[model samples]
Target: MDTKTVTDHLYYPVSAQKMDRGEGVYLYDSGGNRYLDCASATFNLSLGYSHPAVIAAMKDQLDRVVHLTSSYQSDPINGLVQRLVETSPANLTRVHPKVSGGSSANEGAVKMAQHATGKTEVITLFRSHVGQTMMMASMSGNAFRREPFPLLYPGSMQVPDPYCFRCFYGQSKETCGLMCVDRIDDFIEYASSGRVAAVMIEPISGNGGNIVPPDGYMQKLRAFCDEQDIALIFDEIQTGIGRTGHMFAAQHFDVEPDAITTAKGLGGSGAQVAAILTNERLSGLPAHHHSFTYGSNLLAAAAANVTLDIVRQPEFLANVRHTGDYILERLRDMQLRYPAIGDVRGVGLMIGFEMCEPDGKPAVKLTNHLASAAMEHGLILRTSRYGYGNVLKIRPPLILTMTQAEEICDKLENLFMAELAR
Candidate 1:
């Protein structure tokens, strides 16, 4: 490797090229090689790199202030919060800027839920990737990731996700009648002390192969949580910020959650920041209950403010929907040409298509090969398959144009026909 790495990251700058910089939906290396950013630069570059407006905003804020703890108020933070609240679902009236990414926000959300409900347990899906922290890693549905940690979080409970492709109930969606949702009570009663503080779910399981549940899945889960009086927390770190053609994925199902944790794209600038958006009812945490030193960094908040302004516009969201539809349609067409493409799923730009064997099992080897090969062809896609390794994640920047979508499709078509057809 030409560059020094500090962490065990699997994706990004994979090639032995000292990446120079990025612009729009593209990344450039020191060798001047440009690549189409198909994975949105690890699914966080919502505006893509060097977005002029975001850069200008961050620069302007840097002149006024660099950062402040959450205890102090700053204009950038206030503005970002206002924009988030205004653009969020009607029920998400309050927002708390957390001092960490998805995992921290999730942990904070859980604490708030526990505080409000007086319960310590939470119910999470079997495939939902929460975060990298121990508590989150333990709470995650990915058994392979959690297997090493024997002393995992005790209060977290697991339930089958609404994964229709491999439905846990072993029945078709038409006949199963959402047996996944119907079993929550059984799990709660049989698995826990009958006291779950909250139920956290990813509206579209991003790392779990872009698993978009059936139409009524979110609504059904919402009803169940309401009946059970458990806080419904939607982890929108991957699907939020116009990536889903909506401000939030919950809007797609027309179901509002009790809270939503956002990050990844929220910062807009390459800096990391996250927040826990909740309804007013769940905002009773005592002062200093939770805090991160840099959670409310002024620069990140400035970038996020600019990002929200640009992404929340009706025109911007419409473009995301249109471009996503174009890409999805092309991918579906590819499914007919390639037997490897077992499933084409997702909404907006947050998309994935599983590579599969002839017998319909996940083609993990081929999927991994194709993802690596994509870089050789001047494109960057993500194989964010959790442990399954068959889900080739295709989430691109929200700014992707029709031409870029077609180019990606064309590159993929060629990759499949020329390389994988062997």
Candidate 2:
């Protein structure tokens, strides 16, 4: 069949150019055009494309078995569980590897929270994209995502996130005394059902403009949750597995949450796996209550085990921090030259810069246009909130070297020069 026919038969729209293969951080089209993928193939691929270590591990597991029921114990699964607990925060003692992806992991984490707290309400931040599952879609903050579904999750509410650049309370970070955390009291008392079970948040929001919380925000939130007996869940799908220079963002923030949902980068070279890590208190949910058919595949577990081993290395994580700092520095320089570059924020390789109009409104159209034009400059870029937002994400593979980091910044500068020249 022709490529066009195959594409037409598919359920979703795809780019006209056919990507033939991927190696390291570069994806090559059928025409032999190489584009440095800044989005890391949906923000997974911490080890870049076809990583040798992940592939070898999967190959070794494939020789013995690929999929097995989670009811049975296996070497791969046992190794994965042990490694996850060892690498994750000290408080997260249990690992639930029965979830298929980030969505299910997040939903499972919420279920654990609900089960433990005996509460129904879940709170998230504005512009957050927790997932696309029916419950997650409803729970997510953006109105556009939940607009089509007439029946929505009832007890989910959104509070203002710590986006100091465009603060919801119109207060600066310095003198505001962290009103973003303080104001949640009003949200819980008035907007919510009062029996709030969980407050799930991304340490650095995956699609919500990559907003990083203020210095003391997570600690304050932890205290607030403790005060209210609410379970704190970190949706670390996009920020985990060395993406943030740490095994998990929870480690980076130095605040332990009640639970964490991890996926995306866990597969390293894209083997399809996810898991929920929780404290003993939230580990009461039975395996049957939140397990998928494909959840405990031995092949994926093999991949994850190797992925974790490689990512946990101090030198590997240090490289992520160094490369990320270099890119952030370069982007900050770009911000100085480019007035449209409103805000630059990130940690490790997960970075984003918001585009703004001269009047300070979101430059949504401009953001989308640049993402489209990026391919011409040998770059692959993705817009935040699946294009409803004005932030262009710069989360490349964690395996990115200093030279590759420089290349990304140079190409971005060229893209801006060609398109945004005054």
Tell me how many clashing residue pairs each candidate has.
0, 0
Worst 10 residues of 1 by lDDT: 1-10
| Model 1: how far residue 343 lies from native, Å | 0.6
* Residue 246 CA displacement from its true place in model 1, Å: 0.6
- Candidate 2 ranges with C-alpha deviation above 4 Å: none
The model with the greatest TM-score is 2
How would you encode candidate 2's per-residue C-alpha lDDT over 1-422 as one tens digit per residue?
A: 99888998999998788889999999999999999999999899999999998999999998999999988899998998999999999999999998899999999999999999999999999978899899999889888898888888788999999999999999999999999999999999888778999999999999888999989999999999999999999999999999999999999999999998999999999989999999999977877788899997799999999999999999999999999999999999999999999999999998999999999999999999999999899999999888989999999999999999999999999999998885
What would the TM-scores of all predictions be? 0.95, 0.99
lDDT of 1: 0.86
Please report, in order, the local distance difference test score of every candidate based on alpha carbons.
0.86, 0.93
lDDT of 2: 0.93
List residue ranges in candidate 1 displaced over 4 A.
1-15
- Report the Cα lDDT for residue 387, model 2: 91
